[model samples]
Target: MNLLDYVLPCLWAFLACVGFGLVFNIQGVGVLICGLGAGLGWLVYLVCVNFLTGDIFSAFVAAMAIGVYSEIMARIRRCPVTGYLQVALLPLVPGAGIYYTMRYCVEGETQLFLSTLLHTFGFAAALSIGAMLTSSVLRALLPKLRLGRE
Candidate 1:
């Protein structure tokens, strides 16, 4: 909604991408491109989900867009989509929910903890399913885009 919210998410996305790139040893301009791509992907996802339609359909569309972008980048860079997708998707993870759930559990709030944990798990499952579906669709559509074994 506000500029701070947008800026923070993009900043996190950039940092996640940079961390992933470092772990995978992706160097030079490719790392910069991946970081930028991750930030843009998160921005696009947030825009679509919040502005267009805050519904399951919008979420799936955003996830698919992320997957496609990551896959395309992986193909170009000759690396696995895991590197790009994981970093690009960090913003979508239910981190706050998970943290709250764990915090409640630690504070002896069993009922609230269970409820929050379930919600977090559900959110995580949705994200996983979306990513898996997107990956499958991409693989089916672009059979020639091999990764990592070039």
Candidate 2:
């Protein structure tokens, strides 16, 4: 509800992305870029969730932010977008949902497991759709944008 609520999560997301960057051998400024992208996504997610109805929608919006951010950063640095996008999105992945769903399944809680698994799938779908939509739109538009600038 307050600043700390948003800041803490964004900070954690940034750190997590930085760790993923390291694991993926992303070095130098790339790591920082990935961390910033994660923080940016989490910040968007927090703001949207506060104002929007569903967390799923929030995740979608956040993924769009990360997608746009990664695309721009890649262009600026003249590098592949894959590493930045993947590392940045690490924080937003539904790891906890998968874990809990599996735990519930193992415990024979069919109802909870089913619900959680469905919700997790929905969230994942939203994330992928958001990122893909952004990337596709940008790919279509960037050429026009460059021509205009020239």
Output the number of the TM-score-best candidate. Answer: 2
Expressed as tens digits, the lDDT of each residue in 1-150 for candidate 1 is 688887798888888888777877877776776687678767777777778865444445656667778777777777777766776666677788989998999999999999888877776776677778978877876765544331
Q: Clashing pairs in model 2?
A: none
Q: Using alpha carbons, what is the TM-score of model 2?
A: 0.95
Please give, for residues 1-150, the per-residue lDDT of candidate 2 as tens digits: 788998998998898889889999998999999999999999999899889889999999999999999988888888888898898888889999999999999999999999999999999999999998998888889878882210
Global lDDT of each candidate: 0.74, 0.91
Give the Cα error of residue 99 in candidate 2, in Å.
0.6
- Cα TM-score of candidate 1: 0.75
| TM-score of every candidate | 0.75, 0.95
